[model samples]
Target: MELLLLEGVTRTIELPDAPPLTILSGVDLAVDAGDRISIVGRSGSGKSTLLNLLGLLDSPSSGRLVFDGQDVASLSSGQRDRLRGRDVGFIFQQFNLLEGRTALENVMTPLLYASGRQFWRRREIASAMLDRVGLSHRLTAMPHKLSGGEQQRVAIARSLVREPRVILADEPTGALDVETGGTVMQLLDEVARSSGAALVTITHDLAIAELASRHFRLDHGVLTPVSVHAAEGLIAVSGPAAGPATDAGEAS
Candidate 1:
């Protein structure tokens, strides 16, 4: 049931008259169907770079990356685009909803590229997904009128409507209050579980990251699994990011 995997992956960029910059180095990750993984990292820690590779929007400079048993390196740009559009869903911190589109219409956007039944039933499917996220009454509400939490709910419904194999949420609750964020995370976890899709959440918030069954920390372009211990008003992590898998401790 492994949906996406990375082994010794590295991402580097070239600069004119300067040494090559490496964003990620020897990063290893395995994502399976229904898996819940949280990756915590600060800004400029290469979390975004890793997410792009995971979503098939970018390829690694080196190493093996496989999606559903196919080597991503062998696929053409067109093939990669089609696969990402069909199987990968993204939820952003800003919600990224269409400003002029209604909740239902925003949710239906992904299906616009689909064929046959999905394309024809786009409205139906999107509406149902909104209902699933407890936004049935606000289906026609414009993004400008919705609260931050409500807007994020709409984004969640939109991301899940396609039943993607993998969902990438980049700082999904960054803009909401703690209470609203907790509620949204609960809803997201429930829906993703019901749909059997892998959930990969990238955030700097330890409270939010702890919600996942498995946890990892990414620092200076290196990733490692960690065990989280929540104390009174504080969180303590005990694991070091190492190059090899044997050096990391997976909590789950």
Candidate 2:
């Protein structure tokens, strides 16, 4: 059930007039089916860089990255693309929906690329997904007309439409109000659980991080485990797999 694993992973970007900048270094993480992991970090803490690597949108500069037991470095770009499309679901803070399309159309986009039954029944599949997200009444609503929460829900439907093996949620509530954001996160967690997919959320809020079964903090390109129960009432969930790392309770 190990879906993704990263060991000694490092990502560096070359600068035009300076030495390479290391965005992430010596990071180790494992994601399993039905696991919920939260990574807390601030701006420039390499959270987005890590997200890209997890989603297979980018490769590591060094170290090993294995997705579903295959070495990432050994695969061609096309193979990676196909694998990512088939197994990874992405949710962004901005709810990257197509402005020109309706909610249903946006969800159907993924299945359109799949083979056989999925491709032929893209509309049916997409409609069912929207209904599952409580958007059946607004299937044809345009992005411009939907509220922020509605838009995010549409994005969620789209992500889950493919029934991906893992869900990568990047600051998923950054753009919504507290109440709406809470509702959205609950919906997301419920659907992901029902689908038996691993959920990985990267966020700056400790409150958000506490929802996961295991937590980690990323700072200065280093990843350290955090025990959600060690904060003297700061964390309340008593997360299942969180391990204590020195200074893990410090601000990110």
Q: Tens digit of lDDT per residue, candidate 2, span 1-252?
A: 468999999999999999999999999999999999998766789999999999999999999999989999999999999999999999999999999999999999999879988999999999999999999999999999999999999999999998999999999999999899889999999999999999999976666777898988788999877655433424322257644444334534
lDDT of each: 0.88, 0.89
Worst 10-residue lDDT window, candidate 2: 229-238
lDDT of 1 by residue, 1-252 (tens): 479999999999999999999999999999999999999766788999999999998999999999999999999999999999889999999999999999889999999998889899999999999999999999899999999999999999988988899999999999999899989999999999999999999886767887888987787899878654433222335456334232222211
Clashes per candidate (backbone, < 3 Å):
0, 0
Question: In candidate 1, residue 104 scores what lDDT?
Answer: 88
Q: Tell me the spans in candidate 2 whose CA falls farther than 4 Å from its real position.
A: 229-252
Query: Residue 145 in candidate 2 has what lDDT?
Result: 98
Best by lDDT: 2
Instruction: Give candidate 1 regions above 4 Å deviation.
Output: 232-252
Q: What is the TM-score of each candidate against the true structure?
A: 0.92, 0.92
